[model samples]
Target: MLAMALSTAPAHAEDGYELWLRYHPLATEQASLYRSRASQLIAGSATPTQTVTRKELLSGLNGLLGREPTSSDTVTSDGAILVGTPSSSPLIASLRLDTKDLGKEGYLIRSVTVDGHTATAIVGNEDVGALYGAFHFLRLVQTERSIDRLDVRESPHIKLRVLNHWDNLNGEVERGYAGASIWDWWKLPDWRDPRYTDYARANASIGINGTVLNNVNAGAEILTPRYLEKVKALAEVFRPYGIRVYISVRFSAPMEIGGLKTADPLDPNVQHWWRSKADEIYKIIPDFGGFLVKANSEGQPGPQDYGRTHADGANMLADALAPHGGVVMWRTFVYSQTNADDRAKQAYTEFKPLDGHFRDNVLLQVKNGPVDFQPREPYGPLFGAMPKTPLMMEFQITKEYLGFATHLVYLGPLYEEVLSSDTMAHGQGSTVAKVIDGSLGHHTLSGIAGVANIGANRNWSGSDFNQANWYVFGRLAWNPTLASRTIAEQWVRMTFTNNEAFVKPVVEMMMGSREAAVDYMTPLGLHHIMGPGHHYGPAPWDASEARADWRPVYYHRADRNGIGFDRTRAGSDAVDQYAPPIAAQFNDVKQTPEQLLLWFHHVPWDYRMRSGHTLWYELVAHYTQGVDDVKHMQETWRGMDGYIDAERYQQVAAYLAIQEKEAQWWRDACIAYFQSVSGLPLPSGFAPPQHDLKYYESLTFKNVPGYSSW
Candidate 1:
């Protein structure tokens, strides 16, 4: 429906401070059509949430329709937009819309005749649901959807849709491509930045109900009284928008902050300290969303330090928060340098045995893949393995491995790939989406978290195109099964122009962008070959890290014979972690998906591929194709110079230029390293690397943005 083109004139320069909530005036025809249906607004201010819902509706309608809707207690005119729950508004209660099935956060929007006047009712079971409904209604208008004969009933499939901010207390965000942390701890508890409210609004607009406000590699200082007051201030600002604030807590906080002798979960003293801390936090921020723990992984302290299991650690925190109606989101990203097992199988091995060991309030937050957020990976084995435990899907919205902020790698496709993966735990149709949505496991508690790309940058994310990653993550977190292509199209319409010509190519670009990244960066199941520490660019030969797992060479394992990790039964037996069907597929080199052939098996350089080409030849082809795709993306973007605002269009064009250059760098560096290792001649008609292997290896970055040290 979004099919209007811009007039042939110099459009205004729009710095992307507005994000997807950019309620810019619609095209003249679309505005007129929408205005007719949203002539008047009837919403209550019975609570803080209802008040903000009314404010947002008026603001969005005014911006989109070129006029504010008339505020009325009753439907005085045809095409009035009515919003609220039964308890909040008398008009909504009189409609007698069956909201019993809608639950606390679900909403129903329908066209109904009230007092002989035609009106659109956005009713929900709760005020927060109505707020969600209001945002949905605005989305329909922004995307140019018809409001007439509306009968949309929507609810979040997952219970807790959250954003995990890897932000530190001192204004730094680990793996954060955007600027510094937006929490503004220095000014908080006094000077509340307007950006905080905007942040909450943007999150609530997309149905993200909670946010963990600090880095998962947390510091003990966050639990201190000073920081609690600051966190309390943020909770207040976000509360009106129905977003609860969560904190990532250090497992050793009982000793580091509480002045206890031991932080053991089994100790009565340690339990009492945590219980008191929970009480203190709840008293400060009553609706606080509870703790996100990253214990015994990557040098972070946890219950393992005290000889307790992951469940023991998580349940302890869960018990502390249970009386307050809070939850514990325990991260399952555990891998030990001491253990000589495959890194990908460690999380599953540790948690699979403790399926029902965790308390009801505890959610095992698992990354979408077994490995860290590589451009591509098989869905995490833990998704289906631990049926009794509530597994929370954690996706990284920030392009940490996909060229940080510069590359226009929309992650919707990647998310779709992982979510739609057939885990085959229960049967053929069992998907990771089903596992996390609680449909497969039948768990009452469920969650999905996106590691946030948000920051203090005006555009929120580092680049203009990068904002699409954040938008897509939030939309998909609400309902994981929704097509990524559909979400991309909706985002394109809402963020930029709705013109058919502009929308078609741009959506295609976004949908294919992730695959393009996977192709160039880690084609054919190549994983974690990025530079050590910063992970900025290709470093396949980087064997300099102190730990073997931290080295790029450790992951690729390229020798004179082959270039791949052998994760089959002959190797680490990592394939056995998946369900039987998946394990069988991954174990046999012939049966495995070509994309994941290298991930599961180490093949000879001359091994035959499904394409009838040698493995080495296919690798070279995939790398070359990735570069070509980026070039194609540049060409497609160049054609739309006049379709949107010059500022955004030009910036995107510049970023694509950067992406093309970097894609070439990845292609060249990787090919050079692999060629050196495999001793293979380039297939006919294929170009050699831009420089020699030595030249690629000599390159070093002193200051990459997203590096945790920076």
Candidate 2:
């Protein structure tokens, strides 16, 4: 009867809807081992966080152990899992674990003795800490780690690890590839979706504590009373998971949403309007995180429109949120056509001067690179230059420039590269990681944000490998020092089979995937040459756009004399933004790393590369190398059919085929264009493109998905 009942319970095939929380029944040996340790639950707390902790533990335990565990106030039997702070449970109090320095969100899971009973205690200083501990405990079993004699203490290094969703009010997502917006704004205040709770669970499992629900290119109507009620509903669903809600505030909300005449940051009426708005938000959602502002960039109205500075605009909102303990994530992605000297140097030029001017509650959210999220970019110079202000790193988990979701490019290596790059602000050892983690500058407040790639898709990130990007971002945000390779390995083991045969090769493929994308799409630091408007395929010869910087011809100045942007003192002098030693290296063509050679210098077509080939030959070789890598990735995935679910396996297989074709398109079109400019023959023994230059240029994406944001 018991076996029959178990079989009758509702279950679905693994279509990746469960994400990494797929607590499927483990291998017989592992399941029995975990069952021996987690036979009963002894959760003695009833608070909201504790309730979720109890619920999660029971669900995970039932799925993995193949049977539900009995909940008990006291552990009368052995193999009991005790989860709660000392104050909430007598069993946890008797163990007397030292949780003093664990902080409010940190926890320690240990094997301890209580009342002559041997048990595993997930103890913390608070209930939310215990909740985090619960997720970790399940992860141990899911990853098939030994639970015997466990003694682990964990805490988040960064204070505000968050996700910035570019989802809009009307079910559209800017640069979002997965699907339509998940937030059903029309039915949200009344019809709360169960998916919202699942989203919160996924974020909390990975230590992501906050989310901005709207796009940074914000709509002011989102600030009105109607939308506030919808935001409050989502916040209620997320509150127990320790995730707070934030909004992307349009800088001119006072004028657009309010009845103010002039939306100047210094204007008395504008300041008063913002303070009242803050109070209104706090009344509905008491723990609302704060505002994320993008001002005076890309036609967005800002303080610069009112003859004030970026600091003035940010400080105005910062003052309003101060009384409520909210903050301002002032974006530094500012650029204008008037100052179109170097797109790579614009953010640093603007924000570096106002280093110490921001209020204590405001954080300057700088992108991982100086320019937009290219396939590969040097660390943003503003990271180390601003010491007095808290500089939060903003990474894009979405694949905007790197083939969107169709390409299997893992972003772990990309994140690791920017974080590990040394800034030399406090001498030789100051990595960008230290600067953002508040260790190098000794600033109390610190954070890291990712432009979330999540949407309404069932798989959540469009593809299985793409989920690794989202997972890695949250993991890195919690602790920037963690290795990307390590995170990739863990994600693979949990998301797929733990079998070593599957884990090793998949990790190897992921570790090199980003570099592969870079070699083909934007090798040697060639940036922003994708198709205009839709950014789908190659368009290197495109120069017809009105704005000079918006066109591909402006970035890669390929001519008969040379084929690169010169950022040396004679050119745009963008290399001068870096620290003196770094700038000196970048200014010298011979000293610049070959990966970034084209980014910093305008070299001759006949210039030699370290690979013993002319620049023309080396460039062609990189494009072909990228195409070859995609072929290799496809071959690797074809052999791992039994490791993961058939649905995800086929989805990844189909996407890899798409990537291979697109990679070839990039290689051929870019080569054809550069050859036309340099007037150079193809490298000896190298075949010409599949089509002529005009043929490649004639191909267009008339209706690309996820393009028309407006």
Candidate 3:
């Protein structure tokens, strides 16, 4: 049905040059107000940072407001927009803003009288804050909001909002869906691309101030002097946008790059080597954001290789960087084969015991889920378990599990689910957002990092809709309290048309996308059912992987009599990790939310659901409903043909077609395999699988795109 809708549309434009920053012309009224208020600008001294800020404001105003603001030395009458810091301009000082409260990165925008002229002023404590404020002002215009009577003061809720790019030097991106890696390592130090500058602009537009530029499956060569120069060039490009570049330092860089016998933290030679490396990096890039380490996980080397703890490894790097004001983001995605414990439980077990042992400069980067980014896993136990340690929430913005780039799954709701969850560590309202932002734990430093899905694709993210996930992540990382629906509305208004006709349907489609995906892929919390290695599609019958943990059966634990992994006290007791009230709810089958029914209980096929249908029938209905929802989305988008641009409309229509096809594939494969095991007949009026179980099981694609070895 969706494929038909797309086939009727014209071919899409191949150029993806305009990312979400596409400042298309607004309605007549919006364009008029923007042009009047942002007609001319009087900016202070033109430093490198200020130049970037001026160019951005001019370009965005030209694109969005239908007029360019000319730069001026003095504020003119009536409608000039003034841009400067308190230290640079007397006008800013006279405004009497609480600049002390804004820190270095915060900004204030006010309509004030400068030299008896009514002018709008964007003032900040520093030049970088001015750049941020400039972008904020542009966003309001881009979204077609009034600029008159502007009185806005903004500060980031979290100190560090960073994007962790899993981009390798060889041009392959780990779990990246858009295209090949954006970094062209072959032509680096001398041949810097303008796209790098645009990338920095996009990050600064949202409140993201830092980026880790290498894969966590890191190469020691990144720390070498040769690559340090390459990294310095990238850093220089990003510096003006208030972005600090960080690297994923291979844990054994001391051994591989420094020719050390052992990369042990306690070894004086290794400690000295790391300190010298930090000095070398800081010398080139002064504000280098420091290291992101994936130690003792998936064959990655760490201090644990020598019977030392994670703290020992992190603190060693922290000591090296403390002098340079750098921090270490030590990843807590570790699990040991020797321990034979649940992978979900291993990270908490390893790090919870060493809470206060970490240096102040070190942050424990924990994944949003206990396991890998499954469709729906309970929040990782590490959130509230470590009070003394600053834990940064690591969210995968890439759709590795939720049908990769093909499916239109908005992840804002998923992020909100985890952030708003009551961890109950300190009290009733101990949300995960509080834990990461240092409010609940009362820690000095706080941060949140998103695993970037950005690539060389013209649209930045692979699909047009995938860009929303990236946008929402940055927005939520800036202010975790914002509702997913609100973000979705704003994104729709900016990315597409702001017309109620377009925004309402698109927002509705986006709001239900994740749940629709969960329904088709891992409904009722049955997770880890994707194919091994690539994780492209459903493989519930898969059980012959090299490690028991890698197989789908290890997660689902389905049998002829019943389905689901019983994580109650009788089973793994994973529920015991949560607070008492939450733990007790998850432990009881009757009390548990139906969304997480299969996560906690092994239920019979005939178990009655609250909806009065048998569990098996309800599962079938959910999958069918998910497919129907995709069909509905296709219809809704088709109705919006004249509303959006022809190019984007066709592009999104085509992707929706692909999504509907894959959703059917998921529904058919999962139902066939489940029914084969359950030995139950398809319920009356429920559609049967289009293909046999064996036919669906035999599906394979050895050469799928984006499955790069790097």
Candidate 4:
């Protein structure tokens, strides 16, 4: 019987290979409406970009309208959709659209007339822009939006919108949960997978203009000629889609791959080696999007290794790529485990002094938070501090800290929180969004990256709902000011059923997901208390790591006296890094926002909360609220049975069950550990842990995957 069970085949299911481009046949009424509006596609030229644009329109029209639209070079019908750049199509040129205002990657879609026939024209200054416009048109029909009076002008606000793949050379993704690396390095330069084109299509549809192919714990061999050939092949495939390829280079690559004695940024020989290497790379790939370096942090060699600063290291590389029209994204996620300093204060302490020292093309790629990607963290202090330099915001799309791929935590709210935060650099209204988008201090270069959650999984991201994070990342990357709830609605409409009955509840659940995780996992700015290496389940009792800061106890400092790390002037003085008003608020326990009260103050269990409950009671209430939220989500998902496919619906339902169990585990384990420390009883109505603290502590996971921290 056991042998028979092992031999059983998996059930047939709807694999998530299609992503959000699911142009399934629309409802009957909507299909008729779309068919009339999208009658024929007039693709004027046969450029690679235009060809894909036409093909995509045909595919989308055929799938959504239930009948393929006629393809032609001329306006053969009244509802012809003409698409091209002005230089490529005479009809677009005759329209005399103000394309001068639309940059290379911007497009204008208007309901216009050509050849005595009423038609919709999608015109751009370049072919890639038209391709983006084509995707936009398909999305409208797919989302069942009316395109009758279309006159939309669109462009990405930030100069660089990129996805940083934490993939390694060995087909292993550092923090990937979906599956193995998608790059398939061994098969790459020879076999161009059809998946690559689809990946490009997915990115281009949402205005992602760049991708880093390797992990920041970069291997030196990726800079070798052998891998450069492979990279060139990918460059060719992604060029038409307007995505430039960037590589995360090992800082000591000159020595690791070039047989140099030293990689000192100030060394003349090392500089020459990098300059020659840049020229060599440009000769093979002219449109290469420069290098991303992880140096002096996490044991990666940098200018600091040679007694030089970060500016020296970044400026050295910036000079090498300057002649090639490239830029260096020097990461600002620096900290030292060897030092007993506050982790929250390290990045700002290092980079704040060197603001005006970096070269013209160098951007300090700062993480969204001062510390690592916590469930809830204050916006990084560096956003408004560096007035003379460009700062790119980095967000982690992969849920390393939040229960990996299984938990349904949407990060849109987390991202929106950080982006909308007021850095207060120049008094009122100086938001982090304005700082990174080059509007705060009026700097030219700006970029934002989501450490990609993508992998070889059929669904792109591991689970069905996880794809919303990827979708929202792209949308928010295009325009930082977009409301996350609005993006959620757009995704729900496109990916799942557009029923009003389904969309509202689903969007509400998604909007609250991040906060729910915070309440259950690490509420009120408490962070990094998960399992030591794997970061799987709750481990508030962990303090056994070699480095003190890596342990959960070091972060929470939960004892009989109180709980929470004190970052005010009386403690680590980390609050001093923020602007004066913000600093003062964090310094005072009463003035500090309750959501971040514990982050700045270590209060006793008897301390009063804004809710009129003692700190201990409120904490228990929050943890209980988190578990209850999961139950509500389970009920909500159960009611959404008929809205989506049976396979995806059942998959989400099973995951919700897993999440409920995990949320309970988090609540129980954390509460039991805290109760042990505070010597306090559970609040009157709150339930006690299902098991003792020892039972939760004994639950060790030796093989939980996606634990890559670097």
Q: How should the candidates be ordered by lDDT, best one leading?
A: 1, 2, 4, 3
Best by lDDT: 1
Score every model by TM-score: 0.98, 0.97, 0.96, 0.97
What is candidate 1's CA lDDT for residue 384?
Answer: 79
Q: Against the hidden true structure, what lDDT does model 4 obtain?
A: 0.88
Model 2 poorest 10 in a row by lDDT: 1-10
For every model shown, the clashing-pair count is 0, 0, 1, 0
Query: Ten consecutive residues with minimal summed lDDT in candidate 1?
Result: 1-10
Of 1 and 2, the candidate ahead on lDDT is 1
- lDDT string for model 4 (1-710, tens) is 21112112233456676678776778899999878877888885477788778777877788778877788777777888989999999878889888887888889999998778879999889998999899888888888888987999988778899999999888888878999888989997999877888888889888899999999989899989999999999999899888999999988999988999999999999999999999999999999999998898878888888999999999999999999999999999988887688888999999999989999899889999987898998899998789999999999999989878999999999999999999889998999889888888788889999999999998888998998888889988989999999999988888887899999999999998888999999986688899988888899999889888789988888889998889999999989999999999889988888888778888898989888999999889999999999999999999999888898999899999999999999999999999999999899988899999999988888657766555
Question: Which residue pairs in candidate 4 collide?
Answer: none
**RMSD in order of candidates:** 3.0, 2.4, 4.1, 4.2
TM-score of 3: 0.96
Q: Please, what is the whole-model Cα lDDT of each candidate in the order they appear?
A: 0.90, 0.89, 0.87, 0.88
lDDT of 3 by residue, 54-149 (tens): 777776777676677777777775788888897887767777777788988889998887778878989889998998899788878877777788
